[model samples]
Target: MTTITTRTIEYPADALTMIGHLALPADTGRRPAVLIGPEGMGLSDVERRRAEALAELGYVTLAFDLHGGRYLSDPEEMLARCLPLLADPDRMRGIGNAALDVLRAEPRADLDRIAAIGYGTGGAIALELGRDGADLRAIGTVNAVTTGRPGDAARIRCPVWAGVGSEDPIMPPAQREAFTAEMQAAGVDWRLTVYGGALHAFHHPPVDHTVPSGVGYHPQHAQRAWRDIVDLLTECLPVTK
Candidate 1:
């Protein structure tokens, strides 16, 4: 494993105090940065580890928080909070921008060369940032195929890569088609990958709570999705030597 530095940061967003995790490569020079958005359950060790992994790859990374640092393991609680937040694009943008500001302020991050990668609810936030006209090198999402407001996708200026499970009920074929149509109509550079036989939140690890139907982990596809996301970042926001 590559050596890296990690820390906790507190910032205000969505009318709440968000506790985020920051990870940095060992070297001191400025490098490209990545913003990681965790699943709807909120920030957890899963996201923190992803941030560390990205940092080890030589990019400064910040795993942004949702639900004010609380991890909502209960399905009911997770949906109750995430549903309304996901419905409001402005709110999503606000959360994303707050994290972006923190990342851009880091001395080790190259402000002009930053990308955003997110999962579930976090992925929607990344898309919202792109639709809000935030300058991003790339936007990578996993299982968050939610569409933005009509005509707003045109505001996205970077390449977008989305991943979904072939059997994902939450982001089924119909929803995927709608999202793709919006991207196509907007002429945005985009691509989608469907992992065969996988389900919604396929990237997530097994949990203690009883998950909803069609929500489970697919280890193989999870790694594949991560590799694809890293490739997107490397192609769009390579770390400078």
Candidate 2:
């Protein structure tokens, strides 16, 4: 097993102090890094575990906190916090760039070989960063498939890979069409994978609280989606030893 280390970090963002969980691989040298964004529910054990997994695969990773270290279980609370952030690209970018600065500060992180992957609202953040023209090697998102303002996708400078549940109501067919159209129009190398019979947050594991309609845990699809993300990193953002 690869040796992994984790730390809790605090930084300011959007008028609040944001917290992040950083993880590093056993190697003491520089390596590729990934920034992880969580759903509207905020960062939880699931996101932390994902960061650790990436670290084990020899990448420095950070799971960013969206709610100032608070985990929201109520859908209403989550939407309340996320909706506005979604509508405001600058605010989402503020949160993302803050965690990005923290990740970039890590001595072991390869500044030039960076990627961002997120779920739900976190996914939206990833998209915004791309639209804002961050020099990312790759961008992978799940569930949160919102497109940016018209012409904004033209700013993306890297390959993008997105996944969504086929039955997800939040990102139904029309939304997917618009997203893909923007990607294609911008001539970005983008790919989308839709898992059949799955719902929103299909990549998530079961939780104690109830989720909204068209939202449930799909373990098999979850694993598949993770593999796809890993594959994306391997292809577009491989870290050379």
Candidate 3:
């Protein structure tokens, strides 16, 4: 049976309050913990299921919230909520650090075997954690941006995996090329996988196509991306039986 614990973790100094859902195997012993950042829509059911799925792979997964439980399906509403946070680099750092702190505080969490994964804006936050010198074992991002603090990329000290859709208009070929170049210059062990014909937010099953610039779901790529993420975690932070 799967074991899950849901709780609200308040950020120190009013940085940004977040609700976290921790999922694990029912008989979980000490295991690696993954701090998961949700997409721009915030911590939806999809993100929660992602955490539970990771737990089935023998991980203590923590899914963090950036928007404090408020979610939007409309593009305008989502942008209105996300744009300000993106503008403030310090706020993003605080949110990431707070989530990390929450994960570290869990007794079942293997502090040395911690990793992070994020989707979209959350992906960018995960990258920022690595860039800010967090000693993560690995990092994975899906449809994420790498446009945070300047020179932060040079500080990543762990393996990084980035998954993007070739047809994603927000992150086109030029942007991907630039991101790869930045990682190369930083000397980071990195991998980039591009899924052809997939749009943004391919993993989100309930994508609203009625909206302008809406995204469609791709189950195949989503499953493959999840597999790759788990494989990366297993390679970097092996579980000892």
Which candidate leads in lDDT?
1
Q: Model 2 over residues 1-241: C-alpha lDDT tens digits?
A: 6578999999998888888999999878998999999988999999999999999888999999999889999988888888888899999999998888999999999999999999999999999999988889999999977889989999999999999999999999999999999999999999999999999999999889968888988899999999999999999878676
Query: CA lDDT of 60 in candidate 3?
Result: 83
TM-score of 3: 0.92
True-structure lDDT of candidate 2: 0.92
Those runs of model 2 whose alpha carbons end farther than 4 Å from true positions after fitting are: none
* TM-scores of all predicted structures: 0.98, 0.98, 0.92
Question: Compared with the true structure, what per-residue lDDT tens digits does model 1 show for residues 1-241?
Answer: 5479999999999999999999999888999999999999999999999999999889999999998979998889999999999999999999999999999999998988999999999999999999999989999999998999999999999999999999999999999999999999999999999999999999998988778888999999999999999999999988767
What ranking emerges by lDDT with the best candidate at the front? 1, 2, 3
Please state the error at residue 223 of candidate 2 in Å.
Answer: 0.7
Total colliding residue pairs, candidate 3? 0
In candidate 2, list every pair of residues with a backbone clash. Answer: none
What is each predicted model's overall lDDT from 0 to 1? 0.95, 0.92, 0.81
Instruction: Please state the error at residue 201 of candidate 1 in Å.
Output: 0.8
Displacement of the residue 193 alpha carbon in candidate 3, Å: 0.3
Q: Which regions in candidate 3 have their CA more than 4 angstroms from the true location?
A: 1-15, 208-214
Question: Per-residue CA lDDT of candidate 3, range 155-207, in tens?
Answer: 89999999998888878888899889889888889999998898888877765
Higher-TM-score candidate of 1 and 3 = 1
